[model samples]
Target: MTTTATDLRAQAERHLRALVGRDDATLYDDQWAAIAALVEDKRRALVVQRTGWGKSAVYFVATALLREQGAGPTVILSPLLALMRNQIEAAERAGIHAVTINSTNSEQWAEVHAHIRAGEVDVLLVSPERLNNPGFRDEVLPRLTESAGLLVIDEAHCISDWGHDFRPDYRRIRQMLAELPGGIPVLATTATANARVTGDVAEQLAVHGGEGGSEARKLAPQPTVARPAPQPQEDVLVLRGPLDRESLSLAVLELSRPEERLAWLADHLGELAGSGIIYTLTVAASQDIAGYLRERGHEVAAYSGQTETTERLALEQDLLAGRLKALVATSALGMGFDATLGFVVNVGAPASPVAYYQQVGRAGRGLPDGARASVILLPAREDRDIWAYFASLAFPAEQHVRTALKVLSDSDRPMSTATLETYVDLSRNRLEMMLKVLDVDGAVRRVQGGWTATGQDWVYEQERYDRVAAARRDEQAAMLEYIATSECRMRFLREALDDPEAQDCGRCDNCGGFTVAASVSDAAVQRAGDRLTRPGVALAPRKLWPTALANLGLDLKGKIAGAEEGRVVARLTDLGLGQALRDLFRPGTPDQEVPVPLVQGVVAALADWRPRPDGLVAFESRTHPLLVDSLAHGLSRHLGVPVLGRVAIRDDSVAPGQGATNSAQRVAAVSRRAVLQTEPVAGRRILLVDDLVASGWSMTLAAHWLRAEGAEAVLPLALASET
Candidate 1:
């Protein structure tokens, strides 16, 4: 029953044929070399290759060879569910049994675990977050480490802080590596790592079997693995190849306005080569773009992190089956797929060239020779502001980190994130990321109760954080430069990624003598303008008071009954009137009467509002009394409704300051200042007017008091809503 080299090669070829459904399927030199290192030499390897460079083939072929030699299952640390599903499908085609453990598959974990224990699974896939799970880490990881034939880290750039999409959970892979038995043969693969990230990842991979030596010392929050002094450089093979994509034709289309950009997409989308992706910067943008495209009679769906898991699965299937033209998506649709994507259109500039390369790399992958795919970047002026907003959420200041740790240290019991927010000034997303980093660095522990401090002496690396911040700033500058550059676009990107073989791509817009049309039809532009300018975002009434307000000494606990629903003429972040509203509400600017255009829009909205108001009441604004009074009087004059008095602030000490504090704090601030000043509304429908609605607490409190005073109904209206 012994298997010879010839037999192994034959079996690999068979699997390759099955995977592609072609007899000519074969592996390139680097792919075969990676497979040999894993299956024959049993050494750890890092393959930093471009998309469609057969990185997956290396691991799959190696897995098939190892399984024939009676090695245990291969465990891959995949980043996204989309990736896991794609891997599973590919594995099945190769006749390999594969299963996944992720948030979406919780119902089947018990069965999957049973199958793994029973030795019926050949490959198992898991997300990085799963490594820190209380149950999986304590129960299953130990067994998997001992039995896994080969460990794979897909999208391995995520392990490096320098990576565009760094994940703290991916760092836990080092601990897993330390526990893995010698000669297990690990493989880490990525398509977007530059020289710096490549080096960082290579050192982490070498942490196994004492091979890291001093190179491992180069990493931060150093691996938790206790190693006997640095040994010789391990057989860590780093196979970095050229990242040039011959089948990709790159172009940048600069539009003057957001609406114009949408119009151009409406005009050019159908003309693109095949089914592809339309990448947007935010969830709102994705939804907005999808709605517009659908109205234009194109079949598209919005795919984002906000998308439900089942819906995401369905969308993925539809995209793969070509039932839909494209998915207007945020970065939530992580750049991972095996589809023969023919085009990719980025609606806004990504913050960095590295990220841009990764996104556009999704297209033209695995295309037939001489077949090209289009990659377009529709640059917008708003992209820089969006980039700055995202950059603001990077790792917190040392003082902030220390504040969180000190609070955890002083707590008697485990505290949930919601409770911790009452103490920390950071946003929920930033705090959770910090906690995860701290947990992995041995500064804290997450248990069933909640999170508890571990009291580990964690040193805040100020220099490292500063360097990362500087790199990010440089990347942003580079992106802006890319937009203005006349040099070859692909060459600039490849050089930015430190691709040694970088060269001018003759197929790009610059070298190829082509330019994306800057003109959009007048009709298309008008339709886009109409959609953008159309206002009135529904302001859902607050159903329940924020939880645990009692701990903050507030009497409020349950849902606020009889909460009046409301609407704003526009969001301060809206596409059309946002800038105008933002300018009007800018701090330190003198208050003026309501602008004519905004008044017109508001009047238009009120004309269509359900149940016309019988009276108007102004909410006193300590900062903008003139603006508030003017708006109320204008509404009264325009609609011929009687002007009832204002909701007077009880005292000077109660105005909620301009900055966004938490919901509970805002509500608490409002309760003391918002006093019902006028006579009881008494069975008459009333309109509550305000200059701006930040947290909606002021309106909520006002409505509650008016309803209590026997008002028939309260309809809240605002000039602008700050999200």
Candidate 2:
């Protein structure tokens, strides 16, 4: 029954052949080393290699060998469900039974669990988020970890807060690892980690047995005592390989304008070797670019977190099967599979060099006819601004954390996120991420009802957080430097990733002296310009009052009785005129008559507006009140409508400033201020105007007051929406 090293190799070779469905398939040197370390030595391994490196092969083959030696199933933690789908198929090809439990497959979890208990499932893939799922963590995880023969952490860079894909959920893996039965082999793999991230991940992975993760890190808040010297860390076998790939030809097309970038995609997207990806920084940008490309006769689709799971899967398949020329996507379409991905075009530079490398790694994975992928970055001036926007969402201040902790600690019962928002000042996503970190820190616990405090001592690691923020800023600067660099593009990225074997690939545009057509067609530019300039976004009414408003002492709940959809001239995030409009609303802009161009846009909007307003009522602005006055009066003359009057807000000194503050707080702040000083709106459809709409509450409450005052209909309209 003893399995020798030679015997393990023979079995692995057979599994590899079956997995790849190639008769002569053999393991790469790194793959074999990783496999041997896990299957033979029973050591944790970290495999840092480029995409298409067959990292999966190492785990699958090792699974087969380990199972033959009477080990239990391997549990693979994958980032994306799309990746899980591919992994399952690949495991099936190797005759290994694999099942996934994720958000999309909740209906099948029962069946999967039964299969696992029956020993029919040889491998199980799960999302990292599942580690913190109250039910899964309390019930399923303990049993799974007790019997797990091997643990595979895919996209392992996500474990490092310093990595481009740093996921708060992935941090819980350390807790899972701590409780995992000793001698269960663990394998963590990623294609996009630099030395800093690599060391960070390795250190986390080396948390010896039951005392896991950082001894005590950021994410938690309260107070902590100084710990004694840490014990020696466990040894993790590190398998790192050169990042460069022969199949990828890196390039940069420096088109400074959004129009030129869209033009470039439209002009040459079809000529790209096969279906691929077009990355944008925002969901709106993805949708916008996809629509523009389709108009230009290229078949593409937008993929983002906003895309439904079913639609995302369909779009992913279309790109993989060549039904789509590309999927214009946000980072949400993370690491989807495509055997013939011939290119990866970045509409704007990624926020970091590692992010750029990770995104570009999606291309040239495996191309038919040996066609090299065109990895290009079309960076715009707005890219830095976009990067800063994302950067601003990093860790909140200690005071913000303390505020949320106070709210939770005082609550006797678990509070849902929406309810918590009534007291906390953080946005939904940020609050949830903070809670997850706190959950790991034992400061709070998410249960069946919602989330409750544990009163466990937690320390906010200020020094560590400061370092992380500094690192993030450095990455952004490096991203800027990446686009500005005239040297070898691939070398720049590889070096940025701290790939020890970094060298000029000799295929990048800079090294090969290959210049792609940088000039955009005038007609294309004009069309793109038109598309960017013609802006109007539907402003959705805030239908439901935020839950637990009682906590805020407002007593508002349920759906608002009367709400109607409205329109804005543009979103604050939109390109073209939106940029100009945004500048006008910034902290120090002059309060004068709104520009003629914007006035013309508003006039055009008014011309198309239905249920024509009998009169205009401008909402008082907290900033740039003159602009609103000018816009309202100018529209009044243009529409030949009477000015009803102005609406004023009862000032609340405690109102939080508009930033990343939550909806509940916005509602709380605005609810105090709806004082109608306007003319009677009885029997008339009133036009509710504002300088800009953010959070929609200002409009919501204002419109409600008008409707309550007997307006037939309150039609909310704004110059821009901060969507």
Candidate 3:
């Protein structure tokens, strides 16, 4: 049975119908074009279509067709574990053998590898991060790249810095494509790239010969990887479809308060047609909202990056089977969960309109004609604060990056991130991001023990960084505009992405197609307010000092004993009273006496606190001495407890910010200065008071010293935590 190109295309169409479980299924012309380019012509292509446009079908069908031609396995660089899992399940319906190598399925890697080597795998999915792993990069990648039938980048926009959700790990893809042998089909796909990101990605694809020979735009500083000369730009076949999702009805609800928004969700979640997602800006909000909804009798659960991998799989299944009403989630649950979601509600606006479109695109994916899913936005005032917090963690200053590189180059051996933090002022997240960027740029490498310098020439590229920062600010402003605009919401989103065919969707609130009430019951608002305003969050005791501190010449290592459990009056991100605490502790704000309301709140918190304290002790703060002293004296006076002497610091000792950003360095810095002033009180119960707690190391070290002085218990009380 010799199959011609037309026969193969017809067979692929049949497979698509069988995969979707509808005999009447038909492939869109663009989908057919993309599949043929990959399987028949063996040319490179980029497919930019909206979500649920059968982008997966193009790849799955192409993989099957290519396999029939006796080609090697199809390699897919999927971004998230959830996306990989969904793709693998979808592949199964088409009777294709798909296996994944990821952090979650490490135990089965040997089996997967065996399957690949045995020609038993039709498709192999790996995270882009896997490309940098020493073992995989040196061993598995060479084999896969050399023999791969096709290379598919699921969310291709991540390869470009101009993309809203750019990742450094994706930069490795350019190098991977350059090394790939010619005559191999390559495909890149995304649903959320704007014109700028699209051009950036297209340039890279052209440079890699995905396009026959388009001039490659130098997007970033050149990497050290060896690259071939640019081919002709005619090689790339781009299939861009309309960005609008016709099955969605979009609207915006302006709620003045967090409590009121929560009340509205609790009241209207049941009214939404079918199961959907409720998106939040943070993990704390997701958990809080999920808990509140459950108490109000909605079958909901929280999903975030922090959720255990196994539990996340189960939660996704629950949502898919319609066993749960909604999964309150953060951006971690954003990409590629192929469920026929009926609605989506945003509790807070994302800083980028492109990001918002990608998230809300999850709804109505599988809806039939005449059926529409609801997409609503409930914008909050606190969103800007959250945005600022995240923006502050962006790329480090040039000096910090240089310092890290110099330290790594001079080190005799690999240095762990904790050890590296001892030399850099950047936080753990920022430092790690810098290192990854350097790793891709050929300035550093990650070995078995830790990170090491590669001694390659590096440039700061200030211009590129500035451009990215400016782009981010513009995106934030656009998000604000999206919330305020009286025009079509969907149209605003599409236009933000610079979609060429964008027009009035005629289905958004501003278009008068649908309306969602902004009202909440007074009783529900009162209850939600009570929940939000409720004070006191338990602070878990520090179990162990950070590992490898001894390696940095600090004696502090191993478990931190005698550090009693702690509590805070409230988190800085809490819904109720959070804004007041934020303003009170804001940077550059003058040191002042504790507010009366906070004093009263602390009094309320202590009433519920277990085991009344015998005495109150204060810690001297280099940052806010007056605040600490006032708070200690007020709590002592209100509780009728004795005032113990202060734990003073030596003038010669370093401040908290002067030391490493790691726990061990902070503890070492604090330990050199913290000294008890009063005589030891044997067998006494002590309450340690501080104005604010950032890392909790100082409090832990203080408790260690107090326990050494014969204190029975140490209870840490702070006004607020920077959660």
- Top-lDDT candidate index: 3
List CA RMSD, all candidates: 3.9, 2.9, 3.4
> Judged by lDDT relative to the true structure, which candidate is superior, 2 or 3?
3
Q: For each candidate, give its TM-score against the true structure.
A: 0.91, 0.95, 0.95
- For model 3, the superposed segments whose C-alpha errors exceed 4 Å read 1-5, 209-233, 652-656
lDDT of 3 by residue, 290-337 (tens): 988998999999999999999999999999999999999998888888
Q: Report lDDT per candidate.
A: 0.82, 0.80, 0.84
Model 2 C-alpha RMSD vs. true structure (Å) is 2.9
Candidate 2, backbone clash total: 0
For every model shown, the clashing-pair count is: 0, 0, 8
Which window of 10 residues has the lowest lDDT sum in candidate 2?
222-231
| lDDT by residue for model 2 (341-454), tens | 888888878888888888888888766655688888888777766777787788777888888888888888888888888777788888898888888677888899889887
Q: Rank candidates, lDDT, best first.
A: 3, 1, 2
